[model samples]
Target: MPVAPKRMPFFEHIAELRKRLIVVVVTVVVLALGLYTWGWQIFDFVLRPVQSALELAGAEKLNILGPFATFTLRFKVATYAAIVVASPIIIWQVMAFFLPALKPKEQRYVVPTFGTMVALFIGGIAFCYIVVAPTAFEWMVAQAGGNSVQVLPDAALWFQAVLLLLFAFGLGFQLPVIVFYLMIFNIVPYNKLRANWRYAYVIIVTTAAIATPDWSPVTMGALAAALIVLYEGSMLLARIVLSRRIGEQKRREAIMAAGGDPDEIDALDA
Candidate 1:
């Protein structure tokens, strides 16, 4: 007779998390399968910028290096598309998991923050698709040294590069969401944010350089510039949104400094 396993103290949380994971995986897998069926059609749209760039550069054609490459490309592309298509559900599930941990004040921000995050990610990908993809490919083709060297790009490699840039920019565009939360949650103070602009700029530029698949200065510069704007905008918004919260915290700090009972900091908020 096999005994039943004992549940952990946090078994409910584990179960809830498992449920969310199952939903996300199922959603992605289903979409991936469907997308795989229509891959070339999708790829035609996805590779438009690269296609245009090749034409402008007078490249002969994009070639598949392997007999199995087309199938592999379709599968991979479908998986990426599925992940992207399922992002909203993914974001909602992840945020919902943390909603219970937030105070009522923070709870009100949940919907708007998640919505903004989704929009920003999509916007970032759009920017890359519209701008960086064409620019980077053109630059690359130019490096082939004119009409003497006929540019023949590998289909699999080109598609992979485009995917990397799109996702990198999308992830990069989440900077405001992160900065906004850190300020609102009092994890990082407004003063510190203002003071650390230099360090922030350095990090942003370095991240852009590393994240861009092609190492194109044009792509990196565009991403870095956009991030800098987002950072400043976030700082301004945080100053507005967190003004009252910051004031309350500072008052509580002063009370503690004047020898009030640290345990009674709750009294100060009132």
Candidate 2:
């Protein structure tokens, strides 16, 4: 059999990355144009749930800021839509381009990792839209105490805040996958992570508290608690992966100690 060649040089990898990035950028732009064409309808769809909630709460009106706020809002929604649409393709391109450099076993993990990432990202955004945003909006509105202050919702700012929050939550949810990879590479041992759990818990809570825009203790405290739960969940997953790796390592050692080829042990067991 022909031997596989060594990986490409750093410059070659960079050039490939540049090419892939261009493709992703073009795809996003095309999708954005489509979204812009139907921007108003999409905007209405996005805001419909919040609008209902506001109306139910007896809010007189949802006001937009500045003459251009409407346009900016539509464009912002369209851009975010573009990102949502292009994410899978972008991830696919990246995975395909980088596959040659990864080990066969590691490559097997890619599809599931991508899927988990996509699901987590969508889940985070949905959670923000469904739970956090509405709750925050309601609290803020109630706090206004029927004052005549024009609660003009800036379209651009609203989406910007939502997008950032969504991204933060999504990235936060990737903690498990990250730690699993770290364990796989022996960069962070399971025992070390477990030993530092207390510190990690503190950091997670602090980060969650800071990530929320609301200054209220209620929101910050809730976010912090949620972060702690997620941290523990990630640790649980890391432990599972670490256990599997340890089991494989032991099996290999057993075969070696028995004066048998590790690969042949599988056939013998069969």
Candidate 3:
């Protein structure tokens, strides 16, 4: 007779975690190298918004400041790009590492959630690249003391601001996943979440204020709005995904409320 496989011991679990971490690290590092080789092209795309805003403000190019600025900027860009590109694999490895602890039903949800998370992160970055960065840079340029001041920002700082905002938006885009999982685990119930919109809005605004590196009103407001929409969207998705589970819970509650047979309802709940 074939033997059934036993669960991993504590040390084995630790080893598996270490292995997953290693894979994530190696994937990012390898991707970084490849992206570094194509750094300039990446720049042309990622930096387009800032560059356009600068050009419009009469600055032909960014200030290069010091000898190693270009090298350092390219290196940072490549590393960030690698993280952005390798996000799907990284999220998968991280989620897969914890799969053994989940119930079968829970495990089934993880795969689809993984893809949703990747999409959210990428969407955030793209939104920043295409909209947030461009708008913020243009507004900043316009505020730079009028025509007397040229808007030739330091290359390193420019890249830093742009990258920071991109990452901020990317993470912001994952609000739905966070909300959905909170519901899934009953850490926060669906009805409570829906009922407490004011508090949630406060938290979202505060999170946006902190997460956005610029601390600009524009970026913060944009992220907060996007997150609010995502939060509401998550509620809709949860209702659909957990439709049957939620329906059963409602039925049990109704029986309890109506003073029906508690024993049978309790048995089914358990």
Candidate 4:
């Protein structure tokens, strides 16, 4: 038998949330400080894709318009790095907060789900860096019409765009996990998701358009295609998993109704 979960009063819940937030904040601050110590190295690593793109476009170097721009950019880089470093802890805190609300079976999925979320986020960032960014940059530069106009990107703007694009891709890749949770929690049925494919496609296209850093159709199309594939794949997996879970639940109910121990039935099967 599963033990009942402890209930907390509203104020206690607020206090727990505050404690978690504090932990997250402290972790981020510490990571940010540590990254700031080596900010230049991180900045270089982050700038590689853009630098390569600029070189391919025949640009020499990015322009720094203001004296304080470099400092600000470095700080931003550190902050972003900090967030990346602290992501696992952040995920843990979120999961911990909601664990009490989940049933035993649902709780079993939390760790795996969190792991999947992290993997998908990293995959999204890698996809953007390895494929999307380079292609988009090359395409955008090609639009300059054969050396008629020189491409001189601002250092701050360039870094900001890269960071935004990375973050966008990372978050966008959570669609499957989100869909899985919705179905698992019965917030949305599999039939409804299957029936609403057309609407989902429209939303995914709009999201891809908005999230992509470049205005080029190539990047947008690539993102949209990836999102659509993830959506369909998630739906298929959800259907299978949910069907199995429902079947098992029905079997357990049948065993209970027959006044037989489900645990004994499981042991006998084993």
User: Which predicted model would earn the best lDDT?
Assistant: 1
- The lDDT for every candidate, in the order shown, is 0.84, 0.69, 0.83, 0.82
Error of 1 at 1 (Å): 39
**Candidate 3: which stretches are off by over 4 Å?**
1-6, 147-150, 248-270
TM-score, ranked from best to worst: 4, 3, 1, 2
In angstroms, the error of model 2 at 185 is 2.5
Task: Write down the RMSD of all candidates, one decimal each.
Answer: 6.0, 4.1, 5.0, 3.6
Give the candidate number with the greatest TM-score: 4
Residue range 1-270, candidate 4, lDDT tens digits: 122245788887888888888989999998998889788788777778766678866768778888897888788889889998888788888878877787665677877988998998988889888878777777777788766687777777777787787878888999999888788788998899889989989999999999887757977888898899999989989999888878777877778789987686684334
Model 3 Cα lDDT, one tens digit per residue, 124-153: 888787778888878777787775765667
Quote each prediction's TM-score: 0.84, 0.82, 0.85, 0.88
The parts of candidate 2 lying over 4 Å away from their true place are: 1-6, 52-61, 65-68, 95-101, 147-150, 215-219, 265-270
lDDT of 2: 0.69
Per-residue lDDT of model 2, residues 1-270, tens digit only: 111233888887777778788888999999998889888777666665456446645655556778887877788889878988787787677777867778766677778888987776677667666766666656665676666764556556555655666666665655556666786678977788789988877777777777766655645565666566666676788778778767877877788899987567674334
Global fold similarity of model 2 (TM-score): 0.82
Q: Which residue runs does candidate 4 get wrong by more than 4 Å?
A: 1-5, 146-149, 262-270
- For model 4, where is the 10-residue window of minimal lDDT? 1-10
Q: In model 4, state the lDDT of residue 91.
A: 81
